[model samples]
Target chain A: MNIYIGAENIISPLGSTAEENFGALSKNSSGIKKTEAAGFDKKSIFFSRFAENTNDFSFDALLKNCLKNVRSKISPDIFSSEKTLLILSTTKGDIKSENVNPIGKSVSELQNSFELKHAPIVVSNACASGVIAINTAANFIRAGVYETIIVAGCDVISDFVTYGFECLFAISDKPCAPFDKNRTGITLGEGCAAVVLSSHKTIFNVEPMRFIEGTSGNDANHISGPSRTGEGLYRTVKKTLELAGITEKDIDFISAHGTATVFNDDMESVAFDRLNMQHIPLNSLKGYYGHTLGAAGIIETAICLQSMRNNTLIKSMGFEEEGTVKKINIISENKKLSLETVLKTSSGFGGVNASLLLKKS
Target chain B: MNHLSSYCHISTKEIVTDKGALLFDNTEGLEVNDFLKTVYKKLAIDYPKFYKMDSLSKAAFLGVELLKKENAALAEYADDEIALLFANSNASEDTDKKFVNSYAEEHAPSPSLFVYTLPSILMGELAIRNKWYGESLFVILQKFDAAFFADYCNMILLRNAKACICGWIEITEGKTEAFIFLAEKNGNENNTPLTKQTIEKIYKTIMKQSRPSKV
Candidate 1:
């Protein structure tokens, strides 16, 4: 069963929609900027972002736009009430009520906003939520549960998460430099991406990107931090390859979850070293998209799929001098290649980790 | 061929299962931490940080332990030998609210509390408790889908996972509800074929039955 990721819709710092965002990627632009939210003003944190709020882009509007984009690309009749599942990955999932309206504390009030009558599954797995959302949809496809599953991951930089990261002392007050020697902390950003996966071999006279295989694991080594040895990540990467019947050499490009945090970059470097994939052209989209939290996996995965279709890999924007971690060939500039398969890897708090293999059809 | 034979449900003030007897049932809705402390007292388990663990951690802690007691063979598997999947309707929104409130007040957010905000942490805690770690996944759904539940079990078995814990847990407004089942693959060379009809029938029956703990 070929799970196709067709018509990825994204809204990030660069711009909204795949065309706008990918245009920025191709031009080597940086989306990290000083945030102007009232929440940030109260806090002393300087460097952060809220996705450029284009006119009339509310949460509902974003969903409607994403659905519209996908609708234009795929046939509506395909999803005619056959239990087409909608699995969402998000952290700041309409959580304004809990912050504004003081109730006894329930997340359900926030979840109530995600009631898509056609698509009704939501996943809030912290940073790895997006990958898990994709995994959830793909598993349903493999299990023959639903014919079509729409995996959408989106999160806005809310006062809830923004100040929460600030309180943890993990937010960078300056532009984030992922994998850099002097990297201080992570910069937050917002984006939403929706991917439609189906058991159909092809769709709409287009060959959708194929989801070959993927794996997820937990280090159980820490509650908030990742393993220094990258044991969980290494195991997940190896298992992903094994399940896909591919090898380290088979992966053409590596889309790393480089959040510009000190620990995550270091840990991922060790994981890549163990996998003997150091020379692979690797880059993190965090510099461009900021850390979209739960949406990072889907947002980055969408970009990689777009790049695969165009046969080009976007450069890592903020990477310059190598950090204290092991060295890899970071794509500092856009490059063209016969990229067949790309590996998208992400690790999050609670020692949760995941890697997905995407192949160009 | 994995099937949910029996299951259990635990909340802030109740422990309901198909044991034909009530373990503990109370109407007073204890706070999240205090409820977990009660779980410790009743189960006679010793861990200094019982109250400090996250909701998923506490729930998975209780679910896996009770599951082990029912099926002791679960202990023999390797770290990644068995599969664990969790579905939450609303994950850690309360925690996120608390963290934000604390941050708004300039208080240092506890990493311990930050840890539970992720829905998958519960499954991780279960893996750490028992060495079984074959394939683990955590999902947040608006609600449980019987078809998706059965589909998940089939994939776990197809991926060669020996046993799977497939269920849902939700904690909101001082109320926590969790349902966990220990499902092992059918020994048959061919998996037990479960179609939508059989799953819906099971769901209808289970939905209508009264709480065994209350009985």
Candidate 2:
């Protein structure tokens, strides 16, 4: 069964809609900037936070707004249908809550607010949450469990998360420079992005892309660090391509998971090199999005869809020179590309890697 | 033709298998960490990384160790065929609280504790220990829904994974309990058909034995 994905929306510091975010990328603009006293030590730190995020703006509000936007893009009755499920991808949803149940309350509120018949499944698998959630949806659709599933990913910057990263020194002082020679570390970001996938294409109001296949693999390595050999990423991408019955040549562009952490970018480069995909034009949206944790996969995948729609390739922002030990083609400038198939990849804290394939259909 | 090949459960009070055999019992009212440590010693497994894991991860790790001990076939499966699917209601809450207090009170953020803040890091520990490179997911549900695990196992058994390990772990203070099982595509003579009804039956039966130790 060929699953279809459309009715996508993104609410990020770059912009609210897919068009605005893509436009900013086309202009080579980034959302990351220094925020005053944002660090645990009361020092300034670079973050890609929403300028419109007033003190009143909350995580629930971001999800509600994004869901509303995507709801309008697809059939109005889908949310109430028993065969439709909402899959939420978030690393830390309201982590500041005293209860420490980051997603339980939010899931309940969403179920009540949206009047969803099926209880939403929450995927909190660190940075890979978004990609895993979408893959879960795709699996359900293929297995005839759910005809349509809405995958929403969101993660807001919190002091708990910031302090943790700060202690690890994983946050960059300046904007993140993914796949760049001088790339430092991640710049925290916050956003909510949602995409709808269905077995029936008629449910989508816009032209849907073919959801080819997606899969995940564990690195069986360190918990906090990416594999030195990029074992998990290589395995997942290989499995995805094998399942889709396509070779590396079938993928036009690659949406790489360039988190800007020294080990991360190098690991990704190693994976691509091992797969013999080093020559593929690839870009990392982290320079613009700042590694938005759970939202990174969905936000970046939405950008991939838009790249297909506009026939434009967004450059790897903040990248200047070759960095990794292995050689690869990194998009250095925004240009037109006759894109047909693209692959999105994500690697996170749990020594896990995930990849998804999408094609213009 | 999916089968519940083998299962193991660990709590603060006891460690047992699905065949109603008590592998170990705790009467000293040891805390969760100590109880799991004793169980580990009883199993005579030597992996120093065990101490670095949080209570949740330790529980899942111990459960997997027990599962592998009972069913040698699982240890022999291809590394990518044993998909690890785990879930928890609290989701590393105990470690999250510890990390939060480390900064909020001591004004010192501990990176080691912070790394275990994600619930799925337990799966990482398992993957590293067992060298199982299969697909993994750590979902957060309000409660342990047996039917959900059964359906997910069935969904994967037919497609990618040859065996699925649906692990459920929760460390609520001293009341730490973890249940892990290997669901195989082919059944053994002692195996039960993988179904929602069988899973619920096994869940209730195993959960009833996982009593809390008075810390």
Cα lDDT of model 1 by residue, A246-352, tens digit: 88889899999998888989999999998999999999988787888877998888898789878988988788889847777788889899889999998887677
* Proportion of true inter-chain contacts also present in candidate 1: 0.43
* Candidate 2 TM-score to native: 0.98
Distance from true position, residue B93, model 1, in Å? 3.5
lDDT of 2 by residue, A206-276 (tens): 99998999999999999999999999999999999999999999889999989999999999999999999
Q: How accurate locally is residue B124 in candidate 2, as Cα lDDT from 0 to 100?
A: 93
Error of 2 at A291 (Å): 1.0
Encode model 1's per-residue lDDT on B50-151: one tens digit a residue.
Answer: 566766578768866776776667766667767777776666665665665555565655555655666677666665555443566666555666666777
List where candidate 1 sits over 4 angstroms from the true fold: A36-55, A81-83, A97-118, B25-32, B104-111, B131-134, B187-215
Q: Kindly report which residue stretches of model 2 are placed more than 4 angstroms away from their true locations once superposed.
A: A52-56, A97-99, B211-215
The DockQ of each candidate is 0.42, 0.82
Task: Point to the candidate with the largest DockQ.
Answer: 2
C-alpha DockQ for predicted model 2? 0.82
